[model samples]
Target: MKYQDSLQQASDKAAQVKLFLQRTNLAAHPINYAVSYEYISGYNSELCHIIEHKLLAKAPLDDFVMAELYIRFLAPANPQQEQLLQEASSMVSRMAAYSDVAAEQLDNYIQQLDSSMLQIKNLGADTPLLNIVNQLQHSTTEFRLSQQQMQQQLLLANQQSHQLRHELEQLKQQRLLDPLTGLYNRLAMQNQLDIWFSEQPGRRIAAIAVDLDHFSRFNLEYGNTIGDVILSKVARKVSSYVQNSGLPVRSGGEEFLILLPDVDLRSASEIAEQVRRGVEKLRFVSSRTKKTLPKVTISLGVSLYQQTENWYQFLGRTAEVLLLAKQRGRNQVANETMLAT
Candidate 1:
């Protein structure tokens, strides 16, 4: 299902992807080429939409942005996580096998008792000897029953352990996501970035720092409960723009960061503008009072990663850009270029 293009069709798609890369000034790296190929093939509608928007606005795509698109739409699932699950499952299987071996050993012991009982009955002739054989048989039978019961309990314990391990794996996965907005949390964002850098040291990354305009005032005007609703709504709107091209993160309270890999500063700013506009369009009303609330807007700042600086420094620069947007006027998108201006 992943690939349906035949020889001729695949060649044609490859040609178009080459053209797209040339037009957009993107390098023909494997990740970049694959993303372009997907966009040109039109198999991925969401990928096409995001790239089309950038094209319409004449925003250039770079290696960083292309890398991000590849990751969002085409990258394989995390091997480390998969390996962990596989290892855990394997361990449970081994434990279950051990339980089976224990059960088999108990069965062998029961058989031995049966053989001994028959031998004792044959040897007995006196009344006292016969009584001893009866007592021995009863004790052997009770011991056999107890061993079977213990074996059953052991099997049950192994099954429960397997189930518990699976649940723990699920919980570990959920921890990376924000419960409020259904977006990745800060920890997930960091882990993703770390992976990106570890795999490719020169990987380009662009960050869009987003903050709701006059959010504190809005929260003060309405209750925190109402503010939370608005925040969640805004998060949805912002994340929509980044569906498959970037990591939409709920960094902290009332703050979000959209990270696009293989994207240029201009393209990132454009995406940030789209997010700002989208949030501006969301209208909120109090469900209890049936009264409409004031329109919500967001301000954003965009920054491209620098090879000369560390990630923290890059984010700090992004935060600075966001501060500039806030200072100039809320509800606008600012970028590193504007900082120079």
Candidate 2:
């Protein structure tokens, strides 16, 4: 639609130029020169319209206007070298004729004027024409300054826009992160797991529910503040496990969840057992305690996320298995269903 409008505008401008030339007195040299300029402007505008349609169709307003300005400034090039040579020859001939007429007219005007009138016309940098010329020079200088200032303003605005985009992305990451544990929080998991589950079908999935074994003991033995430190330690260990396996998320206080994307019950159980044993062997040394702390363990339950399973069912099943693991022993792994012989 915009291209069509540009074409119509070009056509209308051409028609206007034709009408103007037809009414003007071509016997006058200035009028003929003006007509020639009009033709050149129209031809250049046609090319500008074509380029605008191709390269700058979706470009912003400033870009489009700048492109047109550049095109209008340089409009006399011919694609054919021979044609360009001929056009140059014709231009030279026309310019020579105009120059000759201009020189003759200037000589005549000078001869007709007296010394005083000639001095006024010459007006060496201090008369009315000189003052007008000075004002033009000043205005051009001021215009250039204004353009430079505007360009600086645009650059600053662009930098600010880029910074704002970066900060927005950072804010999104912060929202998905667990500040205390330096792990993905529940909100992140909800989105990540949903996308992962949708991509795979008719495949075995494993959800491992994890909880710190006797976590309250830390608060009882040391303090609530110390318990938080233990939680952070536990979170680090789970994150390490996820780096080796998949992603681990801190669901809430003292609780974490691991997702094994394509693992069946047996494979999931082995992974769960490894995590439990890994925690049991871990020795946490604190700033207060010179010696390594005593045994640490976590109970785990592994379950598959079925195609028909919703987020609620998958999580609920894993939670149920976790309860079974806790009841069976303090540190053990339980599966979604008992293995068949």
Candidate number of the best lDDT? 1
TM-score of 2: 0.53
Q: Which regions of candidate 1 are displaced past 4 Å? A: 1-163
Cα RMSD of predicted structure 1: 17.5
Candidate models: Cα lDDT each: 0.82, 0.63
What's the lDDT for residue 304 in model 1? 91
Which lDDT tens digits does candidate 2 get at residues 269-340? 887887887777777776786767657789888888876755555676677788788888869888878432
How does model 1 fare in lDDT? 0.82
**Candidate 2 deviant stretches above 4 angstroms:** 1-145, 198-204, 243-245, 289-291, 339-341
Q: After best superposition, candidate 1 residue 165: deviation in angstroms?
A: 4.0
